[model samples]
Target: MMRYIGSKAATLPAIQSIIETHASGATSLCDPFAGICTVARHFKRLGMRVETGDLLWGSYMFQLATIALNEMPTFDRLTPTLELEASNESCAAILSAAQKVLAWLERSPGRPGFVTAGFSDAEGSGRRFFTQENAARIDAVRVQIAKWRDDGLIDMLEEAYLLACLLDAADRVANTAGTYMAHLKSWSRKALKPLQLRAIPIVNNHAQNCCSRTDARETAKTNVDVLYLDPPYNTRDYSFYYHLPETLVLWDGATPTGKSGVPATRRHQISDFCVRRRASSALDELLGQSSAKFVVIHYAADGLIRHDEILDMLNGRGKAQFADLKVRSYNSRVREADIKAHHRIYWCDSH
Candidate 1:
């Protein structure tokens, strides 16, 4: 339910096949631009140690829940506080406790707060990112999460998991397309549905996975057998596309501005890869910093730095090969014909 602009879910099978064919001996992988941690989650299930980093706080939360945590959080301290019944099966007990918390949150009455005041049409804000009721619910849940963290009721992993749940739930009812660049003038069918928080499946790979908030250039240097890079494809800034989730996680109460109702501070989260002039240079810098024995990169054929240029760059590091995965083009203007595009994956063993 966590929508993304360039999710690799569809291309994951092909990428994994290519990696297993070429770099089967790899024991660890790092995804510096781990949007939603989809790639990291797959590789983690394959018994590879994972490291993930991203500029967006929401991405970091997903990584924390899906990659970094090796077991379900027991919520041992909070269990007694909630007066929940104990179970002989530890894992089941913990998961049930988490679900109970989520159910309680869902039952809480909605309250108009920061999110409703800024991101909803309530009080004539004019923005329609979410309905007034949903916005108030979002506000109430978000505030409760912060309160839990402050009251020592949840740890970092627990906090991230809850926030990830909220992010996914909120996205389902949002009035935007895949991205939050703009909202529909009229309410969409999906947006009319009530928000429901659900628990995510926590991965237990038994490997020490690391996640952090850092630039790709910096995290690429981490020692790993394989490094996966999925940078921004075009000039569209992800900060703008995903500002709602970013703001929701930070909960800084920053004033929203412009037609999109994004906070002005979101400008700081823009990446160099979104700038045409700096895109190529950013890739080069990240490649140079990476210490991984194998490097796998995903880029669009018509991305800011063309796929040919990306191949050439990879070849310079070592022997390189590529696979072109066909993707359905999302251009609504060209409805007369089925347009398609290629998402190219380049993998190489570093010299």
Candidate 2:
């Protein structure tokens, strides 16, 4: 998975403990703000039918590859059109088909195209997001995948899986310190490596899971046993931060602007939760629309929406409880090493 800002990967055990204690029998889980689909993947591994939606195309790719897909795509439709090598004896037939496809893509020759023109520093784009060689490779693989989808050589699930693999590979080689708001002034050691596409891990929970690219305002209405909320707590727009990965998802030939090379389409990626004035109201509206037996919210103590305001909103729904876990602050300006900060988890049993 990509290095997301607010991924619950580290806090999975704590979250699972809470869910087990409060919503032990939950058969379905809904995550409207499915950034990287980390939380949804956690529950999906536990055999719950996870429903996830996100505004980011990059996030939706991960959701589609890791959440919605319950089995390794056999690429049966592709076999007739393309010549794929047989899988090794150690690899299962179920997983081998996808492996062969990845191998074929890895051998794709690097071609300088849209990605090279806009994102590679060596190509005179002045953006240090990727090396010219790697950017060209990314361009080649991305365009090939899109062509396959356009020509009906690959299905939606297969296309999503391939795109997700490319996105992760690109992130590994991205010249940034986590977010792509701006690339590093100098190239990082990892950015110099050749781009390689590896088969991503596939999860099979034996449940029918679904994922969509949509606004949380509409997805909040999904009925489920457990509803998890982890909306943005600050004003950093993800579309601006991870726009490069999204370009791989959209494949739109939108011209890049400014020194950052962010897509012009990024202007439409605003979220109400990022604005201090609309943050609380947006969350309130989501809560009002949610129909879940158990609602779990993850928030930072130093968030724009105050602690009391969240408690007030949660309490109004039903019996609400909260637990605080101490963690280091995310602020780079804080010089003090001993300062204590925590993320608060509020759970409600909406009877």
The residue pairs that clash in candidate 1, if any, are: none
**TM per prediction:** 0.92, 0.93
lDDT of 2 by residue, 19-66 (tens): 999887889999999988899998898889899999999999999999
The list of candidate 1 runs beyond 4 A from truth reads 83-95, 265-267, 329-339
**Per model, how many backbone clashes are there?**
0, 0
lDDT of 1 at 123: 84
In model 2, the worst 10-residue window by lDDT is 328-337
**At residue 80, what lDDT does model 1 achieve?**
73
Candidate 1 residue-wise lDDT at 76:
70
Q: Report the lDDT tens digits of candidate 1 across residue range 20-90.
A: 88887889999999999888998998889999999999898898888888876667767677634433457
Question: Candidate 1 — worst ten consecutive residues by lDDT sum?
Answer: 328-337
Q: List the global CA lDDT of all models.
A: 0.85, 0.86
For this target, which candidate reaches the highest TM-score against the unseen true structure? 2
